[model samples]
Target: MSPFAKLLLVYDGSAEAQAALERCAQLSLALSAQVDVISVVDAESANAHCAGLLSDLAFHRLEELARSTLDHAVRQLTGDGIVASGYVSFGRLNDVVLRHTQAFNPDLVVVGHRAQARRSRWWGSRSAHHELTERLGGTTIVTVTLPGT
Candidate 1:
Protein backbone atom coordinates (compact mmCIF):
# COMPACT_ATOMS: atom_id res chain seq x y z
CA MET A 1 0.00 0.00 0.00
CA SER A 2 1.19 3.53 -0.78
CA PRO A 3 -0.18 5.02 2.44
CA PHE A 4 -3.41 6.43 1.18
CA ALA A 5 -3.71 10.06 2.31
CA LYS A 6 -5.94 11.56 -0.34
CA LEU A 7 -9.50 10.61 -1.30
CA LEU A 8 -11.31 11.68 -4.46
CA LEU A 9 -15.09 11.75 -4.10
CA VAL A 10 -17.36 11.96 -7.16
CA TYR A 11 -20.83 13.40 -6.76
CA ASP A 12 -23.75 13.67 -9.18
CA GLY A 13 -26.25 15.30 -6.80
CA SER A 14 -28.35 12.16 -6.57
CA ALA A 15 -29.43 10.40 -3.38
CA GLU A 16 -26.84 7.72 -3.98
CA ALA A 17 -24.24 10.43 -4.58
CA GLN A 18 -25.10 11.97 -1.24
CA ALA A 19 -24.61 8.63 0.44
CA ALA A 20 -21.21 8.36 -1.21
CA LEU A 21 -20.28 11.77 0.13
CA GLU A 22 -21.31 10.72 3.63
CA ARG A 23 -19.24 7.58 3.32
CA CYS A 24 -16.27 9.64 2.14
CA ALA A 25 -16.57 11.80 5.24
CA GLN A 26 -16.51 8.78 7.50
CA LEU A 27 -13.59 7.26 5.66
CA SER A 28 -11.67 10.52 5.72
CA LEU A 29 -12.10 10.67 9.46
CA ALA A 30 -10.98 7.08 9.90
CA LEU A 31 -7.94 7.38 7.64
CA SER A 32 -7.05 11.01 8.35
CA ALA A 33 -7.20 11.69 4.64
CA GLN A 34 -7.70 14.85 2.67
CA VAL A 35 -10.73 14.72 0.39
CA ASP A 36 -11.20 16.31 -3.01
CA VAL A 37 -14.83 16.39 -4.01
CA ILE A 38 -15.56 16.56 -7.74
CA SER A 39 -18.61 17.00 -9.98
CA VAL A 40 -18.45 16.44 -13.75
CA VAL A 41 -20.88 18.28 -15.97
CA ASP A 42 -21.99 16.32 -19.01
CA ALA A 43 -21.41 18.97 -21.61
CA GLU A 44 -21.93 16.53 -24.49
CA SER A 45 -25.51 16.01 -23.42
CA ALA A 46 -25.95 19.70 -22.86
CA ASN A 47 -25.09 20.28 -26.50
CA ALA A 48 -27.62 17.77 -27.75
CA HIS A 49 -30.42 18.91 -30.07
CA CYS A 50 -33.12 18.28 -27.49
CA ALA A 51 -31.19 20.11 -24.77
CA GLY A 52 -32.75 23.43 -25.75
CA LEU A 53 -30.73 26.57 -26.42
CA LEU A 54 -27.75 26.58 -24.12
CA SER A 55 -26.27 29.99 -23.84
CA ASP A 56 -23.18 31.16 -21.99
CA LEU A 57 -25.47 31.91 -19.09
CA ALA A 58 -26.66 28.32 -19.13
CA PHE A 59 -23.08 27.08 -18.88
CA HIS A 60 -22.46 29.50 -16.06
CA ARG A 61 -25.51 28.17 -14.29
CA LEU A 62 -24.23 24.66 -14.68
CA GLU A 63 -20.91 25.73 -13.16
CA GLU A 64 -22.78 27.29 -10.28
CA LEU A 65 -24.71 24.10 -9.70
CA ALA A 66 -21.52 22.05 -9.73
CA ARG A 67 -19.89 24.41 -7.25
CA SER A 68 -22.90 24.32 -4.98
CA THR A 69 -22.94 20.53 -5.04
CA LEU A 70 -19.24 20.41 -4.17
CA ASP A 71 -19.73 23.03 -1.47
CA HIS A 72 -22.45 20.96 0.14
CA ALA A 73 -20.25 17.90 0.18
CA VAL A 74 -17.36 19.85 1.68
CA ARG A 75 -19.65 21.28 4.35
CA GLN A 76 -20.86 17.84 5.31
CA LEU A 77 -17.33 16.53 5.67
CA THR A 78 -16.14 19.57 7.61
CA GLY A 79 -19.18 19.35 9.85
CA ASP A 80 -18.08 15.85 10.64
CA GLY A 81 -14.59 17.16 11.58
CA ILE A 82 -12.98 16.11 8.32
CA VAL A 83 -11.30 18.87 6.36
CA ALA A 84 -11.53 18.61 2.58
CA SER A 85 -10.98 20.48 -0.69
CA GLY A 86 -13.45 20.56 -3.59
CA TYR A 87 -13.35 20.91 -7.37
CA VAL A 88 -15.74 20.97 -10.33
CA SER A 89 -15.23 20.47 -14.05
CA PHE A 90 -17.44 20.63 -17.14
CA GLY A 91 -16.90 18.14 -19.95
CA ARG A 92 -17.70 14.58 -20.89
CA LEU A 93 -18.24 12.95 -17.50
CA ASN A 94 -15.83 10.08 -17.98
CA ASP A 95 -13.09 12.21 -19.48
CA VAL A 96 -13.51 14.93 -16.90
CA VAL A 97 -13.32 12.39 -14.10
CA LEU A 98 -10.25 10.67 -15.57
CA ARG A 99 -8.43 13.93 -16.12
CA HIS A 100 -9.15 14.98 -12.57
CA THR A 101 -7.94 11.69 -11.15
CA GLN A 102 -4.73 11.96 -13.15
CA ALA A 103 -4.18 15.57 -12.15
CA PHE A 104 -4.90 15.11 -8.46
CA ASN A 105 -3.41 11.61 -8.18
CA PRO A 106 -5.56 10.67 -5.25
CA ASP A 107 -5.09 7.37 -3.46
CA LEU A 108 -8.74 6.42 -3.56
CA VAL A 109 -11.77 7.39 -5.63
CA VAL A 110 -15.34 7.21 -4.38
CA VAL A 111 -18.50 7.09 -6.50
CA GLY A 112 -22.15 6.02 -6.48
CA HIS A 113 -23.56 3.18 -8.56
CA ARG A 114 -27.09 3.69 -9.87
CA ALA A 115 -29.01 0.52 -10.37
CA GLN A 116 -29.66 -0.25 -14.03
CA ALA A 117 -32.78 -1.83 -15.44
CA ARG A 118 -32.23 -5.17 -17.20
CA ARG A 119 -33.03 -3.70 -20.57
CA SER A 120 -30.85 -0.71 -19.94
CA ARG A 121 -27.98 -2.91 -18.84
CA TRP A 122 -28.22 -4.91 -22.01
CA TRP A 123 -28.25 -1.67 -23.95
CA GLY A 124 -24.95 -0.59 -22.29
CA SER A 125 -26.21 1.72 -19.61
CA ARG A 126 -23.01 1.85 -17.63
CA SER A 127 -22.60 5.07 -15.67
CA ALA A 128 -19.67 7.46 -15.78
CA HIS A 129 -18.75 6.43 -12.26
CA HIS A 130 -18.11 2.86 -13.31
CA GLU A 131 -16.17 3.94 -16.37
CA LEU A 132 -13.98 6.27 -14.35
CA THR A 133 -13.30 3.58 -11.78
CA GLU A 134 -12.14 1.19 -14.44
CA ARG A 135 -9.80 3.80 -15.88
CA LEU A 136 -8.36 4.81 -12.50
CA GLY A 137 -5.29 2.57 -12.97
CA GLY A 138 -3.46 2.24 -9.66
CA THR A 139 -5.99 4.20 -7.62
CA THR A 140 -8.48 2.27 -5.55
CA ILE A 141 -12.08 3.10 -6.37
CA VAL A 142 -15.05 2.48 -4.12
CA THR A 143 -18.60 2.36 -5.47
CA VAL A 144 -21.34 3.20 -2.98
CA THR A 145 -24.27 0.88 -3.51
CA LEU A 146 -27.75 2.27 -3.97
CA PRO A 147 -29.90 2.29 -0.86
CA GLY A 148 -32.95 0.02 -0.34
CA THR A 149 -31.65 -2.40 -2.94
Candidate 2:
Protein backbone atom coordinates (compact mmCIF):
# COMPACT_ATOMS: atom_id res chain seq x y z
CA MET A 1 0.00 0.00 0.00
CA SER A 2 2.80 2.41 -0.77
CA PRO A 3 1.91 5.89 -1.95
CA PHE A 4 3.84 5.43 -5.17
CA ALA A 5 1.90 2.36 -6.32
CA LYS A 6 -0.66 2.73 -9.10
CA LEU A 7 -0.32 6.33 -10.26
CA LEU A 8 -2.67 8.24 -12.54
CA LEU A 9 -1.62 11.47 -14.25
CA VAL A 10 -3.89 14.02 -15.93
CA TYR A 11 -2.00 15.19 -18.99
CA ASP A 12 -2.52 18.11 -21.35
CA GLY A 13 -0.21 19.47 -24.06
CA SER A 14 1.44 21.89 -21.69
CA ALA A 15 4.88 22.25 -20.20
CA GLU A 16 3.40 21.73 -16.76
CA ALA A 17 1.71 18.54 -17.92
CA GLN A 18 5.04 17.32 -19.25
CA ALA A 19 6.61 18.05 -15.89
CA ALA A 20 3.88 16.07 -14.18
CA LEU A 21 4.40 13.18 -16.57
CA GLU A 22 8.14 13.24 -15.82
CA ARG A 23 7.47 13.24 -12.11
CA CYS A 24 4.98 10.41 -12.45
CA ALA A 25 7.51 8.45 -14.47
CA GLN A 26 10.15 8.90 -11.82
CA LEU A 27 7.80 7.74 -9.12
CA SER A 28 6.61 4.82 -11.24
CA LEU A 29 10.21 3.68 -11.66
CA ALA A 30 10.84 4.04 -7.95
CA LEU A 31 7.78 2.00 -7.05
CA SER A 32 8.10 -0.40 -9.98
CA ALA A 33 4.49 0.46 -10.90
CA GLN A 34 2.67 1.41 -14.07
CA VAL A 35 1.48 4.97 -14.70
CA ASP A 36 -1.64 5.83 -16.63
CA VAL A 37 -1.54 9.14 -18.48
CA ILE A 38 -4.89 10.56 -19.58
CA SER A 39 -5.63 13.44 -21.93
CA VAL A 40 -9.21 14.73 -22.19
CA VAL A 41 -10.57 15.59 -25.64
CA ASP A 42 -13.12 18.11 -24.28
CA ALA A 43 -15.98 17.52 -26.71
CA GLU A 44 -18.31 19.61 -24.57
CA SER A 45 -16.30 22.75 -25.14
CA ALA A 46 -16.07 22.12 -28.84
CA ASN A 47 -19.81 21.41 -28.98
CA ALA A 48 -20.52 24.91 -27.73
CA HIS A 49 -18.91 26.40 -30.83
CA CYS A 50 -19.90 23.77 -33.40
CA ALA A 51 -23.66 23.74 -32.53
CA GLY A 52 -23.10 20.26 -31.06
CA LEU A 53 -21.95 19.07 -34.44
CA LEU A 54 -18.25 18.73 -34.06
CA SER A 55 -17.22 17.56 -37.53
CA ASP A 56 -15.70 14.12 -37.91
CA LEU A 57 -12.58 15.69 -39.34
CA ALA A 58 -12.30 17.99 -36.38
CA PHE A 59 -12.93 15.17 -33.94
CA HIS A 60 -10.34 13.04 -35.64
CA ARG A 61 -7.91 15.89 -35.46
CA LEU A 62 -8.51 16.19 -31.77
CA GLU A 63 -7.93 12.48 -31.31
CA GLU A 64 -4.71 12.68 -33.24
CA LEU A 65 -3.45 15.57 -31.13
CA ALA A 66 -4.27 13.71 -27.94
CA ARG A 67 -2.63 10.53 -29.14
CA SER A 68 0.49 12.41 -30.08
CA THR A 69 0.65 14.02 -26.69
CA LEU A 70 0.05 10.79 -24.80
CA ASP A 71 2.33 8.77 -27.03
CA HIS A 72 5.21 11.13 -26.37
CA ALA A 73 4.66 10.89 -22.65
CA VAL A 74 4.41 7.11 -22.79
CA ARG A 75 7.63 6.96 -24.77
CA GLN A 76 9.44 9.10 -22.24
CA LEU A 77 8.24 6.92 -19.40
CA THR A 78 8.97 3.64 -21.14
CA GLY A 79 12.41 4.83 -22.17
CA ASP A 80 13.18 5.41 -18.54
CA GLY A 81 12.28 1.82 -17.62
CA ILE A 82 8.90 2.84 -16.22
CA VAL A 83 5.69 1.00 -16.98
CA ALA A 84 3.20 3.30 -18.68
CA SER A 85 0.01 3.47 -20.72
CA GLY A 86 -1.87 6.28 -22.45
CA TYR A 87 -5.59 7.03 -22.84
CA VAL A 88 -7.56 9.77 -24.54
CA SER A 89 -11.20 10.44 -23.73
CA PHE A 90 -13.89 13.08 -24.15
CA GLY A 91 -15.80 15.28 -21.68
CA ARG A 92 -14.77 17.69 -18.95
CA LEU A 93 -11.22 17.29 -17.77
CA ASN A 94 -12.19 16.39 -14.23
CA ASP A 95 -15.02 14.09 -15.25
CA VAL A 96 -12.86 12.13 -17.66
CA VAL A 97 -10.02 11.95 -15.17
CA LEU A 98 -12.34 10.79 -12.38
CA ARG A 99 -13.94 8.18 -14.60
CA HIS A 100 -10.51 6.77 -15.45
CA THR A 101 -9.46 7.04 -11.85
CA GLN A 102 -12.41 4.88 -10.88
CA ALA A 103 -11.49 2.34 -13.50
CA PHE A 104 -7.77 2.33 -12.72
CA ASN A 105 -8.19 2.61 -8.95
CA PRO A 106 -4.83 4.29 -8.66
CA ASP A 107 -3.34 4.80 -5.26
CA LEU A 108 -2.46 8.36 -6.24
CA VAL A 109 -3.52 10.99 -8.77
CA VAL A 110 -0.76 13.19 -10.20
CA VAL A 111 -1.71 16.52 -11.75
CA GLY A 112 0.20 19.61 -12.82
CA HIS A 113 -0.41 22.51 -10.52
CA ARG A 114 -0.16 26.00 -11.86
CA ALA A 115 2.48 28.27 -10.50
CA GLN A 116 1.31 31.77 -9.64
CA ALA A 117 4.16 33.20 -11.66
CA ARG A 118 3.03 31.33 -14.78
CA ARG A 119 1.04 33.11 -17.46
CA SER A 120 -1.71 30.52 -18.07
CA ARG A 121 -2.84 26.95 -17.39
CA TRP A 122 -3.84 24.48 -20.08
CA TRP A 123 -5.65 21.89 -17.98
CA GLY A 124 -9.03 23.69 -18.42
CA SER A 125 -9.20 24.72 -14.74
CA ARG A 126 -6.98 24.52 -11.71
CA SER A 127 -9.84 23.98 -9.29
CA ALA A 128 -10.62 20.58 -10.82
CA HIS A 129 -7.73 19.02 -8.93
CA HIS A 130 -8.96 20.54 -5.72
CA GLU A 131 -12.42 19.12 -6.34
CA LEU A 132 -10.89 15.74 -7.10
CA THR A 133 -8.99 15.79 -3.83
CA GLU A 134 -12.18 16.50 -1.93
CA ARG A 135 -14.22 13.82 -3.67
CA LEU A 136 -11.60 11.08 -3.43
CA GLY A 137 -10.76 9.81 0.00
CA GLY A 138 -7.84 7.55 0.88
CA THR A 139 -6.44 8.24 -2.57
CA THR A 140 -3.53 10.59 -2.40
CA ILE A 141 -3.36 13.52 -4.83
CA VAL A 142 0.05 14.80 -5.92
CA THR A 143 0.62 18.20 -7.52
CA VAL A 144 3.83 18.40 -9.53
CA THR A 145 6.03 21.15 -8.19
CA LEU A 146 7.51 23.20 -10.94
CA PRO A 147 11.20 24.06 -10.99
CA GLY A 148 10.52 27.53 -9.65
CA THR A 149 7.74 29.38 -7.93
Candidate RMSDs in Å, in order, are: 2.0, 3.6
Clashing pairs in 2: none
- lDDT, candidates in the order shown: 0.82, 0.82
Could you estimate the TM-score for every candidate? 0.89, 0.83
For model 1, what is the alpha-carbon lDDT of residue 19? 85
RMSD of 1: 2.0
* Model 2 per-residue lDDT at 52: 88
lDDT of 2 at 120: 41
Backbone clash total, candidate 2:
0
lDDT by residue (42-148, candidate 2, tens digit) is 87788788998988899889889989988888888889987788898888887887788788899889998775523344544446678888777677898886687
Candidate 1, which segments miss by more than 4 Å at Cα?
49-52
